[model samples]
Target: MKSNINVVFFLFIWGFLLACTKAADPGSTVIIDPVVDVDYSDTSLRLQDVAPFPIGASVSFNHLSNDPKLAAILYANFNELVFNSELKHGALVKADGSFDFTTADAFVDLAKDMDIYGHVLAWHRHQGTSYLNTLVGNLEQQELLLDPGFEKSTTVGSPYWFVLNSGDPKGTATIAVTTQTDEVKSGTSALKVVNPTAYGTADWRVQVASNNFQTVPGQKYVIRYTAKSLSGSGIIMVSAQAMDGSGVTHYPGGDKTITGEWQTITLSFTPTKENYRIVFNMGKKADTYLVDDVSVYSEVAAPDYAAIYTRLDEALHTFIGTTVGRYKDRIRKWEVVNEMFTDAGEIRSNANSPAPIVDGQKEYGYFIWSEFLKRDYGYLAFRYAEEADPTAELYINDYGLEYSDKKIDSLIAYVNEIRKRGAKVDGIGTQMHIDIHLSQAKIDKMFQKLASTGLKVRVSELDIRITNSSTPMPPTEALLEKQKEQYQRVVASYMKFVPPAQRAGIAVWGVLDQYNWQYNGGSDYPNLFSTEYKKKPAYGGFLMGLSEK
Candidate 1:
């Protein structure tokens, strides 16, 4: 009877174990189709073999170092390698002014080993804020004007300067130097201009004259001063004028709207005369204006509009010299300036954009660099890249130009403009990230437009999305076939439109569908290969496209 009880207990334990196994087994409930792997080596044609230009891909340095599969795919398919993020400004320069090049060194070493061409030298975005701000701070502290902070005072007024009431003599505007500690914007004193009543004449003004110093003629000078209003709202017309024997001639300055908060106004001018005076026309309003920290000096001594631009241009050159100078022997192609324009066909402006805060201090962005450099920013970038790597083919790269006519036109115009400014741009890179459904005619037109510029054209970042906006449908056989045909047409169109000489190369943006950045919501197949390093049907399509006349 005891033996019988032991057998029953054993059976009960076996039943519980079976139940647990069944619950843990996910394949038992769902059907998973086996993936058929296709070795690209076994294929009739490879991407690197059939292409006239060097076939390239933008690769992640981390993945290139860590993932053997990714490295194998890149090595087999591509002859040229472009880093997606590793070589950008922010990656190279650290906050402490030292460069971290462990990843970059590894990448270059791999490129050297694999016989892959290293492309790209400089780009605009992802720059180190702390390093750049330090440069700006150093220039700002270099004082040029005498008693710029309004700390020194004389019997006449502020040291080395005096107040003048010009224009309508009948106007009831008064001026004085104030030592009010609380009201001053900087130092222990400020220049106060009070207009008690509104003047009938528009030219009624209060001016500040330099007593001993005089501006150099035909030299760039920066005039910077702090100003605020006693009332919450008023308008102050500010101008830097040459008060010579002839008369007062206004330099390049404008009106400033004042609120309760203290604001610094900086202006740049090339003086026509040796002696100049800064004029603060406040007779139009019946309000008190408090001004402090007035300064006037050559562009080299101060950070004005032109000086900021000069410094930025120098910085760009320095960055390129440091980076490209180090790797020019290995890298022969560069995307000098990347994505300078917005999708709306406008230059990216930082006039009102939010500034980046580093260590609790706000720093300038790339837009500020662009603003200071103006249209010459691109010119300087290309020039600097060439100076660093003279043999490298520099290309200006931008996205959305392929789809939009306005954007393409703007890009062409910009290229021409830069060329006119003596920048020797070698190629134009159109980031062809398009949907499969986009018109082939539009793509052909974009290629033609780029070709007309007489510069080498590169289809820089090529990737096609196979999904609609709403959902990412599974990659059915029919959809895969359709995607294959679309890839064939694109490759064929590129070959057909671009002359063989001007075709710099076509680079696949990414290697595998699973690793594609476009696959955000669900499973979307966009690349020529699968996650398991198997060539998809799109691979065949690319080969066929190359085979065409």
Candidate 2:
């Protein structure tokens, strides 16, 4: 009878809240539900009581930063900080392999000196190999494949190509190209003839020397040709001239041979103060080659060593300065450089070198996505960060530490080497990205061994991917009970290490399964929250342990 009364009271309160009238009150209204007493309890319960710290929830910079209420809730609750950054560009080591540190230095100076932390170092994955390969291939090889029609294409800054009058090879192969200064154009729109197309003579070539064009260096250009061979192999060479404004007389030259298949060629070259021209030739007879599609940009410059450090500095500032920057603060130690030690630990893997594949491993090569961190950039990046923030800890994070005890032993040895070489080493971030079933015991033990290094241990970016389901799995009564038990077990285990402080805080990689890396969580259960952000059994279990409020 008491239970039935409680249910009736709940509905009454629900209806009152739902039926509140702004028509009469306008601003706010209150609702009330009657309390009822129940019989002596006989309910079963599981998990220890929650002891929520005085702190609130973690502040996420991306979304929650915009909400004042949520932000206040976090500030009042959790002391954790989080910050995002704008150092989108990574510092480039120069072509000569020297650090410039201009861009990076500026950003870092702002952070380290100013006591900011929102923009600590990040890997900046936007320029991954897939993106770079496309940029390089298109600019260097495919840009030159344009068809030159009778209507000449715009040459506000296109390389000058000699379009020979197909009628015959005369001293006047009309150079119908546009120049910026208009020095080449005559009264009726005829351009001056430098090295005009000749019948069959010396390997004749006409090129738009990469002269004084007001554009970024290393821009891509398309060298196109529409040619008809009358007699000789109609060869048209589009070579980027060496930039040294020597009256177009002393131009550095290389020749690109054109085929009879009406082809367009692309060249990715850096332009200098020297004159660049498009040279055309027929080797023996009179033929014509027309051209189009020329452009320039400033994206791919030689490594700006200075800029690398400047950006690093900026990232550090954003990471530590704002409320959003709190996430980085909690990360007392971070993965400075990514991957350092292979199973062998000798041949570095960053600059496109291969890693030694484990025996019977199907994947071979250094930097294999599934295996190694694949390079030393992770190390170098960490070093720069340590210099900027001398006190805060730093680390080299990687996966595949499960090869054997030998691998972890080698990493320790490797960190020692880096420290000897002036790197401020702190700890290792082992990504527990795989499903728990694959190697749960090994994963747990790996943490134990890594902690033995005397450096901090973090379950950085932890997420167990469940790929099979799009919606929440209906928890069987048994499964819900099991989930509660499992969460309690994990939490309790971590509490054991509280005495030593060797283990820092553990963070779920994302808030929910939907936001996690495995967008489609496979068969494995992931996260303490459901996809909708509603608390799940795991959440209640965790909060029960964390909150004593």
Candidate 3:
């Protein structure tokens, strides 16, 4: 009986071990504590709630527009949307003058309920170059002078001539075209210069020259003009002076004394520079001179600006009619003209070479546009933009305005000048693509100055970078914290400086760091979101800034 009982105990122990082994098997059920659901969304702040004005992001049309996560973030946080490149002139207008508004339309359709900011109506870089070239191709190959007769004038000054006086302290010299009908040599009018004060400086003379005349170096050219003195007989120095930013090089074409009767003076010389202005200098004696029918011609023809103006006007009208008019309801704010000046506060000149090609044709270089339209291009762009969308708020958008005080000053002057010319400019766009290392004082000063302009100011394309070089390393937590501080400071500066009425809004450059253009080949943590679409500290910092009074 004892042996049988011990056997049963052994069998029971073996069965219990087998049961334990089965419980520990891979397929065995295991109970765990219930996971406490933590909501990350509660810690997040809505951008629009913090911002006094509209909060916006520059969005790409592809995935950002449709992706559930991105769309959720954008829709929930932003009330305004600016397309990264969809609404640009190049994207909208095709090479054949036909518009492919597919991308732009898609963007508009997506953001139809939100406020849409049109990127640019006219920009030298992103134009439909092929269409623009086609408009001016024939004129580009030929040499022609504009308004040679000095007949057309909507204002007091002559259309194509820039009148300058040297050594006159009282500024008595004045330029006008005589409309008396009898003073003209060939046409109905003559360029009339009245200089009452005589200053004895050798360079002290009344000068009239063609503003946009192109001359080839080492190329022969003939200049002919008819002139007569009304009061005093004096020798008028005729020369072809190259008006390149470097000191003027005066190519002598000899001098001719003008009497009472109209005398035709012909001068022939080869220019030493590419851009030559045919200058007529009336010597020191104060007198009234009448000059007419000025003609300049080279063996190789130059651009005919009068005809070119017609084509350019047509092109501009077409562009405005198609893009601005089509989406007038959706897009009410436009960067009418963009990047007109460089960082040095100088008007950007495309004199050296043509801008990079877009759509298989050379973009409209700055020199070409300035030469054709003179300073009226900006005015005309604004005018047409206003005409297309009468309610649209127009802005002159430029980069480097924040750090470069001189650039901001110049841009202010430019905007004022455009407004003075009867063009409607509602705001100025300062593209604050800056580094965290930039002086906070300088940034504050910039916002102050911009606000002083009294026009609505928009901090367009706001991206703060921590890295300096294209080859970026993984940013440290400290560096990211610095970036967050900067982002907060920028938003706070904008809020404190920019008046509420004049606040056009701010647009973050992009949604993610991985997609930032500054991220050359490596990591650049510039944006408020990480590659995984999680909001970074900078996002909260931006919110904190806007939350401030």
TM-score of 2: 0.47
Which is better, 1 or 3, measured by TM-score?
Answer: 3
Q: Best candidate per lDDT, number?
A: 3
Q: Return the number of clashes found in candidate 2.
A: 99
| Clashes per candidate (backbone, < 3 Å) | 0, 99, 4
Considering lDDT, which of the candidate structures 1 and 2 is the better prediction for this target? 1
Off by over 4 Å in 1: 1-44, 113-124, 134-303, 351-368, 468-470, 521-523
State the lDDT of candidate 3 residue by residue for 129-173, as single tens digits: 667777775432333457677776622344477766633663467
Question: Each model's C-alpha lDDT?
Answer: 0.71, 0.41, 0.74
Candidate 1 has an lDDT of: 0.71
lDDT by residue (tens digit), candidate 1, 1-549: 123223434555556557667566645453221111223234554577546567778778877788889888887777778777778777788876677888888888877433333344444456776676665553443345566666677322655666666335643566766887777887678777777766534734555565445776887777787888988576676566666775756645566778888988888888788776666677666788887887777765545666666666777888777887888777777788877776667665565334567775455334245656767778888888878878888898888877778778887899899888888899899888876787878888988889888899998888877765647787788888878888888888888888878988888888888667786645578888877788888888876677545
lDDT of 3 at 36: 16
Q: If ranked by TM-score, best first, what sequence of candidates would result? A: 3, 1, 2
Model 2 weakest 10-residue run by lDDT: 47-56
Displacement of the residue 420 alpha carbon in candidate 2, Å: 5.5
